[model samples]
Target: MRQPENLIEINYAANQSSVDVDELGMRDMQRRVFAEKDAQYLLVKAPPASGKSRALMFVALDKLFHQGINKIIIAVPERSIGASFASTALVQHGFFADWEIEDRNNLCTPGGDSGKVDAFLRFLEGDDTVLVCTHATLRFAMAKLPASAFDDTLVAIDEFHHVSADKDSSRLGQVVHEIMSGSSAHVVAMTGSYFRGDSVPVLMPEDEEKFTPVTFNYYDQLNGYKHLKSLGIGHHFYQGRYTDAIHEVFDPDLKTLIHIPSVNSSESTKDKIEEVNRILDLIGTFEGKDESGIMRLRTPDGRVLRVADLVDDSDLMARSNLLGYLGQVAAKDKDAVDVIIALGMAKEGFDWPFAEHALTVGHRSSLTEVIQIIGRVTRDAQGKPRAQFTNLIAEPAADADEVTTAVNTMLKAITASLLMEQVLAPNFNFKPKEPGEAPEPGTLAVKGLKAPPTDRVRQIIETDLNDLKATILQDPGFRRAAAGQLDAEVANKVLIPKILRERYPDLNSAEAESLRQHVVVDSVVKAGEVKEVGDKKFVMLAKKYVDLDKLDINLIDKVNPFQRAFEVLSKSVDPKTLRVVMDAIAETRIEVTAEEAVLMYPKLREFQRMEGRVPSIRSKDPHEKRLAEILLFLRRAKASQAKVNA
Candidate 1:
């Protein structure tokens, strides 16, 4: 593959090389969560590498030694993360005790009982301080033991984002809810990113308020890094397959970990052998093996890269053997393997300290996934002063609406996240989007501020985004509008302004409206819905009018970032059929109080009685729940009012 003429490169300023030293006796965020002595339920919202795992150890140990806790169960999402609780040297780091875990208790190992009910039961009978297992194992324990058996025990859920606050969640969520309701157990919930982009709260507000929150920020972690200087995140689009675009974005000289797209992706041949061959052939064929049996590839740039193929390819034995050697490596040797090519590996909790870049070939599956993949490169390495994450997403040739919508929606989400990251980093300032000069979608640039953000500014932005993202996940009108497809008046005027006012009660109508416009502009531009004119750049909102400046909230054009993307998604679904779905979504967002929703319910049922069916076709949508809640609230309210009158 020849290098494409267009090569997009973006660089960001480095963060400070060191952080403020913490006082002895407590880790960074642990001090707050630990100090909440009156609280039984604790929620720790911290960033990755902020010592959250150790914080859990400290809390769990306190529960056992001081509180009335007999057994402790630590549940993680995956097997690899189980190692987080494995016998760490916490005592040496100024803790009361070491996290002592029996080797046998780590039940996520291969052939071991990942559903380790018997092991949990046995541990309960005896005296085991901590039993580390996967989420699957925790579910099995709940099934085997009586709910009463959980009494006097402390259950800590790590990666707490997986536990949906709503009833629609899986066992991980159901298990925690049951533990809270049915048992007298203490719960400590921890997550690197507490706000799930999916909109389902990990715990309902009523449940969440009971827990004391220990929070950390991105600004804190990055500003205090020991070795890392700066971080860059970029998204590059190609004409066809990502493999062809690899040369356009990937820098072979940088120590990188390449995650080959899944077999389902256009870049993957669905055959591992062919993928490896293509990667090697694109870079350079091996001239020969090195002294230590490392596969040396002389790239087109003429630099030799010690490539380690984690996937089983034509050189199966050699690739497999090199992987074994990497596993035993205690510390990074700068002279070691230069690249790691993996398929379904090296993603979460897999540490390769020397890695300088984490490059991928697709729009990440979820916002959480994008965070985790970027985490792979952000870790500080000895000689590496800066790190980067490159997302080489495939841009299919413009064809029908369905494909285009999927691509654009994905691009929108990716760019929004990237923008958020830079804002939260060391110093960031996003100039209000001026009307005539919008940056083209997928065009790369880094914006930084000279002055650092005050703690107040960081808190406000975080609160605004956290609230906005939650609405994006759950609210039909807002979600659709944010995607820039739903061109409803309420979303632009009523819905968004109302939210901003609520987040900042002090803001007047004018201030709130101005804030709302800037937000909409951010969404529109980042979602890849803008185009360049002769000299001015115009955002493609309604009729495609060139904008003069960023502060004009009331624009001459109708704005829906997803408007174009929605057109693409709409091509697949019949326009008539989509009207039915949209109607249901709007009707369900009933926005009534307990009394109003309840009163609305029987009315809803009567309407259904006349109409012969529920409003929505999708069984799992939130509006379904809202419908029932409204009816119940209305009936109960009337009944109580009758009682009061009597």
Candidate 2:
């Protein structure tokens, strides 16, 4: 078996005149072709709308006429996908211009006109022909082909994962492994889902480290957020049970694509009919008068049909009506809302940019399947940021917890994979950020935080404190204790004092008292209490006051002023004098009635605003401020407004 000469300076543009290099899909294909050239095998993994088929079609032409390498085989998991590719090559890419493509179904060759299997093998060994067939045919041909048959051939496998895991010995995997060991040939395996670490060994032999995995998880590489925003794609996420909450978020202006799995074979046909009626009912309510109100349905039978003109009781005639409606929609209003109600069949290969929302009701546990469903809604296109909304509908019987866990894990994996590729991939060619495009101020400030030796221990304590605060805040009885009204004795005896001691263990009784005095002042000032502490007082004049703002509130809150005099003297302060100041504040309890609670609500809002917290208040009716104001006014206002004049 002789090695074929490398076809250098191949004029891809000259051979394929119809191929548009500037198209997003074509440019993506070119990147894969170059990256894969150095490997013994290459895998192209992409999602539904990522244009995997179109990429393969262009690559096929470049390999055949442009590269002038005659013996090339294009294999697909299903006969339909293969036929579809062949049709596109002939009609769209002009591949059938000067050459005839032979299918495995009918062929007669030098092997004495044997079965279609034998004839296909002989055709591959013969001159200038491209073989397009299914995995079954490819396996059969490979098993019967002579040792010299694949010496210079290139095998392109579509939906390659099916071959690696499917029932029969995957013809593509088997042949590629055999050829790499015995002959010199390049194998390209393409699929939307390429589970790399697990599928690699089966797809390529263990010894063959010459495998390059190229993935275009559209959301990761395409910067879908920025791209979609540029195209005016508005993202709407409705977080609740799908069936109940999804309808509320539906925008009649945008076309919707719904993916719902059929229950079973018997129920699928019935479900399609019901789905058509529902779509018609919704579209009829549209205020605007346009042909855009059309509904197109893609059935399980692989036929894409429309829902217009179908009589309510028509049986098989409904299928034809669907087909007619689809034809009109595809031809005339291509960008119209395409409401697709499908089972899991459309998960991988379907791509419709006009679909702005996807509602999935399918019961699939595979991460790949879930990713594919989400991918359908994230496709990049020109008009209206293709499918900016995704709604997942769970079956009644589904375990909500298990489903959420699985979906979250899958999402994390997608996000991590995207980040890794962006930051680590060698040949990654994303544009460098412009000067103005850099992150906003303080964005990367935390990158300078040097970890302390006790960082982990400190984190645990902080987390515990946060959790405790949340629990306390949520308790109805605890919330009734307005700002200064919380029983300090109970707090001091319980976890609050313990946590404070843990955070400030060095504070002695007198120093702790000074800290508590400051906490009172800070809290009072925050509550709009503008009373001033006299400067001539001993406590206020301690060394003309060491900056009180720098004092630890936790340490201050636990002080016993009578225990030590120099504890205040350690800071050049007189304990007896400071006690008077502290006692004065203590005597003025400033009772925090429910009315005071209401008055203090605005301070909470102001604190939240200053701290950059999410504004939870949406309106004044349910607003915390309003609630506080109403409650306080009722408690403190004049009797005329408060009392009923019965």
- Residue-level lDDT of model 2, residues 1-646, one tens digit each, is 1111211111111222122344333454445654455454666765554556666655555566655456777776654355445534334433333334644433222123236576566676577457766666777776776545776667777776565522254556656666667766667777665432221224432422355666654333344233243112211222333334445544455555555445452112345556545554544443232343244445444433432322233554554445344444542464444455554454555545445565554333343454555555555444644344333322211233343333232222222222222111112111112334444332211121222234332322222222222222222222212222233323332323333343344545443333323323222122121233563211221123322222333332333211111121112213442233233323333334443354445655675577575333232221343333334454565565557653
- Flag clash pairs in model 2: 305-322, 305-323, 306-322, 306-323, 306-326, 513-559, 515-556, 516-556, 566-569
Q: Model 2 TM-score?
A: 0.46
Q: How well is each residue in 522-549 modelled by candidate 1, as lDDT tens digits? A: 5544443346667555555456554433
Most TM-score-accurate candidate: 1
lDDT of model 2, residue 565: 16
Runs in model 2 with CA error above 4 Å?
A: 1-29, 35-39, 47-69, 83-122, 125-128, 143-148, 165-176, 196-208, 217-221, 224-227, 230-246, 262-337, 395-646
TM-scores, all models, native as reference: 0.67, 0.46
The clash number for model 2 is 9
